[model samples]
Target: MALRSNPTLRQRRLGAELRRMREQAGLGGSQLARALGINPAHVTQMESGKTGISVERLRTIAALCMCVNEPLIEALAEIITDRDKGGWWEEYRGRLAQHFLEMAEIEYGAHGLSTYTMAFIPGLLQTTAYASAVFARGFPRLPPHEVDLRTAFRMKRQHVVRSGKTPYSAYIHEAALRMQFSGPKVQAEQLGSLIEDSERPSISIRVVLFNVDTLPVNHENFTYLEGPIPELDTAQMDSGLDSMLYDAPAHTAQFRSLLKRIDSAALSEEESREFIQSIKKDMERNYG
Candidate 1:
């Protein structure tokens, strides 16, 4: 088969795990190639996600590497074999950046998700007006058509949360709640929407106030996507124009720890609802 020119994050992750398995078994690339009956170049391609691996081959790899983690192996198998199923995000593939589609795919497969934001609302929870404002501020400024396209893509991403099957938790700073990307009216509506979302059993919205002594991490926006197995979890960091995904054990662990700390520093769901309500009322009074 023709090798892939651009592999998705999940494909790369599966490849990475395969490489790790080989290393754990103390087998070099050439050595593993001999064991797998493939050339060294083929091994390299597999490890770089430039090629696909069959389930039988994956099983052979696990057996050769002496990997007994059944769940992780199962998860890896799913990743490699599930490529044929195209997601709704595929429709936007040529129009949007690859990261956008990858994010949607990641969210769709996530068992649960947790997000932290300092300056803006989490994308999954943003309203159309608020999202449009946020996108409008992009450097080089987006055309109205592009803004609408991006906004639609973002709203589509929310489907996973709206399905009520995935548990979604967002830890938003007080500053984020106060920032009126468009204006107070839009911000107020966004806050009110947050309150309504919070009432859902699967959605949790927590507010972190400015009074906290210090934050565990810098004021970056990130989302932690929980996979079927902890080892497969991913952390995605977002800057307005770009996003980076990290699946390395250390990085994901650090993100997980930081998110936990943020969770602790945040108000309880009920308290956060009241807090958001207060902010909405303030906006209405001052700018209604």
Candidate 2:
């Protein structure tokens, strides 16, 4: 079969895990190639995500590599099937950066998610108007068509928090609530929408008041996407005009720790709701 021209993140991840397992077992590509009865180049191709490997072959590879993480192996098998499924995000392939589609796929498979934002409401919780305002303020200033497309794409990403079972916690700074992105009317709607989304059983909204001192990971906005297995988890953050996904153990651990500390600095759920209510009332008094 012709190799994939552009492999998805999950595909690449599966290959990476296999490569790690092989190295841990002290097995070279030639040794594995001879074991699998394929050329050494073929093993290299699989490790690079240039070609798909059958589940049976993957299991054989694991056995040869002496890998014993059953759960992780199962997750890798599931990722194999996932690559075959052309998700809804496929429709926007060439229109937006590949990062957007990869993000959607990552969130779709996430068992849980935690987001931290200093300058804007979390994307998954944003209402259409709020998203439009946020996108409008981007550098180079997007045209109306692109803004609408981004808004639609963002709204679709909310499905994981809405209909799916992925539990999500968003730690938002108070400044974002007062930014007044579009105007009073739009801001009011956004505050109202935030209140509504916070009520969802799967969604947790926590506010890190401006007064909160020394918040964690204060440098930028990011989302921590949790996988079924710890080894498979990833952390995503914006890098320039694109998104960067981090799956290295150290990076993932740092992100997880950052979240724990951020949660420590944030208001409790009930307190956050009350805090948002006050913000909304303030908005109504000033904007309405």
| Top-lDDT structure, candidate number | 1
Give residue 214's lDDT in candidate 2 (0 to 100).
Answer: 79
TM-score of each: 0.97, 0.95
Please give the lDDT score at residue 200 for candidate 1. Answer: 92
Q: Which stretches of candidate 2 lie over 4 Å from their true place?
A: none
Q: After superposition, how far is residue 168 of candidate 1 from its true place, in Å?
A: 0.5
* Lowest lDDT 10-residue stretch of candidate 1: 212-221
Candidate 1 per-residue lDDT, tens place, 1-288, comes to 899999887788889999988998899999999988889999999999999999999999999999999999999999977977888998998999998999999999999999988899999999999999999988899999999999999999999998897999999999999998898999999999999999999999999998986787764788999999999999999866688888889999899889878878999999999999999999999785
